[model samples]
Target: MSKKSTEQKPEVATVALVQSAQEEEDTITIPVMDIFRQMKKYFLPWVLIAVIAAGAVFGGAMLLSNSKATPLTAMVGFTYDGIEKGLDPNGNEFDANTLKSPSIIESTLTDLGMDTKKTDAIRSAITISGVVPDDTIDELTAYKSIFESTNSVDAAQKLMDVSYYPTRFEIQFAYGNSEMNRSQAADFLNTMLSNYKTYFMRTYGYNDALGDALTAVDYTTYDYPQALDVFSSTLNSLQNYVSTLSQNDNTRFRSSETGYTFADLNESINTLRSVDYATLSSYVLGKNVTKDKASLAIYYQYRIDNLNRNLSSANEKLATIADSIKNYQKDSMVVMAGADATSSSALTQPSEAYDDLISQKTDAQSSVSSYQQQIADYQSRLDKLNSSAVASKKDQEKVETDMKTVCDKLNKLIDDVNATADDYFETASYANSYSVLVPASGSVSNAVSNAVSNMMRPLLIAEALLFVCYLVFAIVRAFIVSYRRNAIATAAVEAEERKEAAEAAEKTEETEE
Candidate 1:
């Protein structure tokens, strides 16, 4: 139609531009935003699956955690006496090792009616804890709760671990995963205490006939002071009765005076002294009254001698203290007055030394007064002994014999009573130090929060893992779909190019023909 000049427009530029655009488009690069967008389409399904998986995990964990695998706990308390000799015979302070030793466990299990041959079992089941004070049991209780939750491997670890205090110890025993009765726990505790006590008692020699005898003796009844009182009163009453009897006795050679005069006694003593002193002493000793009197006199004389010795010692001490005081005073006076009394520079300030000297002087004077009083009391006793009259030897012999028999019986009773006193004391100490057993609650202490946390932890982890996997799956699917679409577009583009080339070639062939 325009046919004046048929001109072929060069379409090469357009084709090249289109090809270049196509090539640019052919290259597939997925940015992070695209991947997220692709994943967003399946996000709800992924979330659903994750939730379901988490729930399942949670349920499973709960089922396992709530299952009958909890520990049973018992608590027992031991009281310790602070008596060093009784409790620590080995001179070792009470330590946790003594209670936690394998030997102690072996013995304890034996008491529990478990074969000691199964020591490993006992060791595994029982834990002896540190000693604590009586007031701090709550601290141990809180510790046990925390420890049990975290240390699930040995659930029974809290049960047998011991908490020791200075004056006492609290012990915990746990039987793991048992649905036992509270009474059983009580029985276990009692047996444990009994065995533990028996162990110490036997080890320390407290479980013998002597121990029993000691327990039977009452401490309040043991009064040595009372015995002394009885002895003194009996001697005084006997002396009074003998004095009256001597006054009543009007047998031949009875003096005109009510009692023997000093002159008469002196004359008699001289006459007796004229005789062979040894023979007269022997003759006096044959009669019980004279013998007892002579013994009493000798005892009083010895007491007076001891008092004299003490007085001499006290006097010597007083003199030494006095000398020290005098020296201190002299020094103080020298300091106060100065070397030349008129010299003011030489005068010294009073110091504590003077005060100490004055105090010492007062103490020394008090000691002197005490010694003088003691010496006077000794002389009084001596005078009484000299003035007191003994019965005639013949009549005195019978009364002395009767009194001697009674005295021997009393002495025997006194010895027997005193001998058991120490044993009773030890027994009382054992009782005070003994363990007190109470039934432990058998209720399974479930850490509800901990169990839930433990159960939920796995579920949460699973949910996170599954969500990550889902995200990966969704992104991979997006990449695969995008790749397939790009490959189809490229194939179409290549087919078009081949077709175009074929057409050009045919056209050229025709043109050449």
Candidate 2:
């Protein structure tokens, strides 16, 4: 071999040995300046490639990190410079809720044409923003924080620009539409948002009719159909009592004795109803039916007392008549000259009465006439009023009427009691069970509580699937980077050396030739 080739051969073999040793591991050791010099050519390309790859990976990761879609958007023509502009109650104040409310959001999205299967992925990738009248610092701050945590933007270029805002609220939502092409991202978000808005509108307005019905009083009644029989019976009894009183000469008419007297009854009714007599003046005005009845009662009692006085006066007159007859018999003695009281004369004259006897008889007859006159006058008056308005007064009638009224009231009271008892039985037996221990409102809230027992399993399953996907993707990314680095190191180590060496030995070859 030539001297030059021979010298280079060992150098190649030594280079091979170094390369083989370095292949097992990656390391760098050189004079600092020489390291820079040795790597100047390769480092430029490697650095450029590394920078580009880093940028690509970072940008790709940013794009992948958030794959959410915009779920709702609404274009309400109205704008509010202040909090007073909109009165969208039912909790429409939260982020995206105002813009993507179930009302107009679904329509807007439908107009935009979004895909359905990418619901969660689009939601995760998207961000929401708004434009409102710049009336206050709050508005500015809110607008500045346009992107949400869910926004996936590794680079500035992935961000969208929003313009065309009025003083009112302008709202938008963004999602990682990675499942869709860049051109289709907006369309997908718009479609899904449309559907979401529709769902929300249906949910929120579910109780509209109930609210309206609650405000209407058309169903209220002074007396329900359930009370028809009771009212009819009450009116019938009152009418019957009035009719009976009208036929009686002793009274003009009578009202049923509901509880209180006439005046008292009316006053009690007004009190219970909490209305003034003046309001009822047009109907009854100054009339006091109760007072009139009470006065009649008094008048009858007075007549009965007067009759008793007259009877007493007549009795005294009878006694006076008896006394007068006795006095006339004693003082009316007529003394005829031959008729002086002689037993012989009285016997001989066939018991002929003397003048004294005659006078006594005359006085007796006069006293009897006076007694007859007094008795006849009294008897005539009594006969004339046998059927008159005051003959019976109210002594017996009062007791009977009072007893009947009391019985009627008791019967009515019993009916009321029975009705109440029946209602209680029906309500308690057939109505929904009541909660005695817990507050009623709390019990109602419990009934309204979510039926999570039916939905929990599916929700948990979805969560688990998402978590698994995230973990797997994360592990796969890490392993790919690590394996690629190791492979690159092995390849570099093998190709780093390009020389081989051979050895030659000759001893006595010249002498034998």
Candidate 3:
């Protein structure tokens, strides 16, 4: 019984080993050709799924693009000949964000005949950014390295606190929220820029303060002498203005609008002062022209008193300035004229302080002289008023007529000065500081192309992922199908082998019997 059991165990072990070997041999591996064949078989379906996925992605992108409007853009540049210390031509601190101010937006809306209620939308849609150069970082780094090498605390501190503002700026307007079409939005920006330019010119380029002052006084309301004083003051202001312009090297610049140069205007101002103003003053004071006798007496007395006080002050200033000039010591320098040190020359030049003192002394003396002459004139007029009878009607009428003629001439002069000043400023370089370097422009086709370009990368990535997943699915499905078929065939062969082994065993037992 033990022997029979041992033999059966060996037979069972051999059969189990044989079945394991057959199973190992039946393990299927899909080749590249099988994968390729499976992929080809499912190629149309895969293509359809890929097409659907791509269509969905593109459709979503198109819908997203349609929902958000593309912005229209314009470039503007500022160019000024004056010092750029973060100040505009009018000496106000410059801020580029003022481009989208509520006032500007309102003005733009008004100009375009659009409803003002859309101001918020328009302002919100507008954005401004400085167009920085690509080498900005490199330049900044170099600047910092130089300063650090020098160990300059001030320079390093300045670099650390530096804030850069670009001369060029890009303005964008997303008209989707503003309910404006492309053409309308472009016009809005261009018109807004136009209005801003006008505002800039009025605020900074042209100064109407002098002109306003000249035109504001009602000369007819004043007595003859007082009117002459008014005219004198206006002429002085005009003289100062022309002098300032001439000192700025604008003397030869002729205004095409006014047909007058600064030199020509200066000449006109001098002529008015020397001829018209002088003649008017002498005639009025000489004749003792008075609208009211009591008022004239009191005015003359006031003038005399004021002139005496001014004369005293002028005399004191003159004396002090003279003493300063006399006591001032000029700086002296010794220069070697030839190669030999023995040949030396002493040069004594007036210091700036000494020169300034001399200038003050000259001005003080002129003031003193002027005050003395004015006092003398007023005292003579007072004496005439006290001694002489009241003026006749004919005399008063003649004074009135002469004053009218002088006022007319002054008015014409004022007009000419205003025109010349306006023209001069309008043509100045500062007026061209802020301009539309490139006007606002946009195209629908360009917007479409940009939208497509923005979506292209993501679209390609999605399509690539879908293709890879389908390819993996096809290859996996091929392996699974090949494995099942190999497994079924191996099972049938094992069954046949097992049947043959049993028959042989039965035949051997029968032969042994």
Tens-digit per-residue lDDT, 1-513, candidate 3? 754764476488568968887787776555677788888999999889878887777777767766876677788878874324566665677787777888888988998899999888888888998887767766667669879799888767767665455788899888887777767888998888777776666566445776777777887798877888788888888788778877775447787877888788888878877887787677667666778889978988998998898899889888888887888789999989777677988899868898888789888989988899888877887898788776577877877787777767777777776676666666774556788887776466756665677678888998899889879988897887777876798788778777867876776577557
Q: Itemize residue pairs with steric clashes in candidate 3.
A: none
- For candidate 1, the per-residue lDDT at 151 reads 68
**What are the models' TM-scores?**
0.35, 0.20, 0.65
Decide which is better by TM-score, 1 or 3.
3
Q: Candidate 3: where is the Cα deviation over 4 Å?
A: 1-72, 97-107, 115-129, 141-163, 172-179, 249-251, 297-391, 442-513
Residue range with the least summed lDDT across 10 consecutive positions in model 1 = 1-10
Report every candidate's CA lDDT. 0.51, 0.39, 0.77
In model 1, which regions exceed 4 Å deviation? 1-28, 31-34, 72-174, 181-447, 506-513
lDDT (tens digit, per residue) of candidate 2 on 1-513:
555565565567677777767764465332344333434534455556545555554444333333332222323232222223333324344334433444343354446554444444444544444445445545444444544543435322223333333333332334333445433554544454445433433333223343233233221231121122233344344334323322321422122323222233233333422332222221121221121333444544454556556656656655655555455422243343455654332212322334555555566556556555545543443343333343133343333343334334434433332333233222322122111111111122232232232334544565566546544544555555555766787567546533112122121223233
Candidate number that wins on lDDT, 1 or 2: 1
Q: Provide the global lDDT of candidate 1 against the true structure.
A: 0.51
RMSD from true fold, candidate 2: 37.3
Off by over 4 Å in 2: 1-387, 394-473, 476-493, 500-513
Candidate 1 matches the true fold with a TM-score of: 0.35
